[model samples]
Target: METVINLFMEKLRNNKGVGLFYFSGHGVQHEGENYLIPVGASRVLRAADQLRYKAVAAGFVLASMKAAGNEVNLIILDACRNAPFKSGFKGDMIPPGLTTMPTVPGALIAYAASPGGVAMNGSGRNSPYVKHLIAWMEKPQLSLNDILRNVRRAVHKETNGIQSPGYYDELNEAFYFNQQVAVNDLAEQQRLAKEKEKLQRQQAELQAERDRLAGEKKAIKKEKARLQAEKERLARQRERDSTPITPTGSKKVFRDRLKDGSLGPEMIRIKGGSFRMGDIQGGGDSDEKPVHSVSVARFAMGRYEVTVGEFRQFVNATGYKTDAEKKGSCYTWVGGNSGKNWRNLGFSQTNTHPVVCVSWNDATAYAKWLSQQTGHTYRLPTEAQWEYAARAGTTTSRYWGNDPNDACRYANVHDNTSKQKNQGFSWTHHNCTDGYAQTAPVGRFKPNAFDLFDMLGNVWEWTCSKYEDNYNGEENRCAGRKSGSLWALRGGAWYYLPGFVRAASRGRNSHDDRNYYVGLRLARLL
Candidate 1:
């Protein structure tokens, strides 16, 4: 299976066309992880560690395919056979069949059965799935997704109540197995060309108008800031005058109102206080210069990065599509390409793993939905708030300390796993073994002083703050500011080095740019 996967990757890399990977074997889901079993692999059933090492991870295969740069990739798994070694393993270790595979960018993973359901092995040579797939695949002008739907319908009918096929399609462009281009009528083509030209002209005019408005807005903002500073000065004086007297050593913690685990995240109370919110030691970016004091109010923040399962529930309930999903592409480590989206993050993520490939807009949308559902205003943490929470009353590079050796114990940084995966690139991993090449499941490592898990790694988290050249008057806003320019993301990801994964470190991306390494966690007002 590994050799076959290698061959597929080689072919995909060498060609600029579509690629297909069809597997017919035993597949199983073991504790939410999907595996493709090769011939005679059941012998290692009792040795759990050996079995994992021997079997081909579906995630690994998909990751390779994603990196291969294929125009389109199709994966057919008619391998959802029943758990052959169920008796030897623990009851929960093996599910009835393969678990659901998430959508992959520029690829489709079609299963013979719905996740956790058994696939039928026909008495004849080929299974019902294979038979229908072959027939539908040969149909002229039918798209791959369309053909799969037809195949799914046929397989369901043939198996009766025994089986139902499922698919995760991430294709952004139409692909026909048998290419047939229709001739265009001359008159209709001319009319369409004129319409296109008109639309282009209108778009150009609209862009000019936007540019003019933006210039005017910038000028007005400068004037507003001048007056706003004086207004804020008086407001601050008023705020100071009305301050309630409290004991010097006083502390407070605010917990979430909803603890049912269905409506919102499990939050940890952050007892806000005055903290110097930037890189004090000259070891960080220029943006982190002139370490300034910031005062914050008490609030609650997610204990861990929002997981894939949590986001799935939001999507299912609200029918909300992520920006990447709507735009049909997102940035990956390799670069931007069509078909990459939040659903297909170029790597596999279990329910507990952090959700990635989400834009700032998508994060805000999720926050809005969560707020509406829970009746608590959920929003992204402010840059200052995130720094305050992550610091946990500490001023070190991380909440723990400045030692890179301690990284894997508390957070997942670019480690031995990532170095091994990309030998050609120079990796400044902490040299610790975090046991994950990509994003790890949330809370895999120890929590910080605030009891917040994954505040520094697994994925860069979106904050409500918009990016500024340097901190100026923006620090006063507790909820952070939003701008048309780039937005801020705090924390570093599993792929970044320990240097970038600091409590005071800052990263920014365009508001609309979604990448596999970026995710979000919400903050709720106390």
Candidate 2:
């Protein structure tokens, strides 16, 4: 079953379309973590012995596909053969329930029987659950909810009420698998939305300061607050894009909104100045040396980092294929295994998880896609721009502090103290697991002096400068990507020791290297 899933996952890495998984066997649940009893699945989910298959089951799968971590996700689970290993659950384990479980955002889990009941098996080779699932999936134009209802009825009738299949057990909303809504629909929806009234008001209040600089009239706190009304107007101005219009409407008109500013947000102002680009701290790598102060131009950045929801918008608009999406595999660091890909990896994330496994090219493509969609010049932040925004105006080596363990608290660093050692005594966390033990929520931890989060630890951020082993102390006087050397990476990752996280710490990896730790932030030239 693991092999089968691995094969399917190989396919899942790229295609953002509908996905269907049919587990044809037993299932179990302990302590809210569900388990799919793979062929001869044993009581333990330990990987030490592959003697029998054990997995975090339909529960884990359902949660993953729903990763809508900014993209929409849908899942269907057909296994409910029998709760074979129910008795073997160890301490702190909760029995599986079919009817209901706590809700996961952007996720819906289904079962073959009502919560806490056994699933019915067929007298023939196939399980009663599988028959209904296969039949229902073949139905046309059936809303996901209606199909589930139909499946529950059929399974119940076949089992003579013995197996009452549960779907959206807690009544979680079903995302219609057949009528897939692509990015364009969602963007248009946002286009007509007057919802960002509050957010607009907030940005508007900051505008006076946004319009201010040295030698300018200082914005009084009250004046900034007074601009909330103006925000309502901008919300209305922005709201024109969301109204659902006919698909036959002129493409050029709609294209104009996206390009000109259909659904654009205000830019985050970054103060331009000089700062040491590479790590000057001793524990950092040699590549981090030749610390040089380079003057950066001021620019406005996306107030929030690009989000999964936003990325999905870009894909829907252009039908763009990401590198990983095209490759049919995504590089992920596997626990207990040295290498892994998208199929085995699960995507349980809030809308906030930092986009991971994306390449420098992929990041750039997204920025480019956004520019085309909304007619904005969004691109990966230059090395200088990223630091300015990340610092939010703190002079410390780390935005939070020099402590790397503290990184675990605020960002998703080496928080797996049980697997690794826990050194951070006082720290922050994104309030959730980093999923891959690699990437965490974008906003995890408190923001820096500038209100930016996860700048020092979590994932390695990409920069624009070409890699140079020895740069002149005057970085402004440096040359572009030296021969053989690639671009630089900053901050550290969960897998790295603390030494790599210093603000000035510098290191370089190949442009072709796609690992779990690499991700990038974007900035636009004013």
Q: Which of the numbered candidates is closest to the native, going by highest lDDT?
A: 1
Runs of candidate 2 exceeding 4 Å displacement: 1-266, 335-344, 416-436, 472-485
Tens-digit per-residue lDDT, 1-526, candidate 2:
5566555555565666444555545555544445666554453432222322446455556545544232434455554433422112210122433335555554445677777665655644456777777678766667667878898898889877767877653333445556634546777768655566767778888865556642243456335533642553355345445534334453211222465355653345566777666564455445556566667787665544455556666667778765666665554423311233222344344546556666566676776676666556776665556666666655666776766644544555654331323211112332222323555667644555544556677677766666556665322322243445466666666555455555665555555445555666666666
Expressed as tens digits, the lDDT of each residue in 319-357 for candidate 1 is 988888888987564322478886776677789899998
> Candidate 2 — what's its lDDT?
0.54
What TM-score does structure 2 among the candidates reach? 0.44
TM-score, every prediction:
0.51, 0.44
TM-score top scorer: 1
Candidate 1 all-Cα RMSD: 26.0
Per-candidate local distance difference test? 0.75, 0.54
Clashing pairs in 1: none
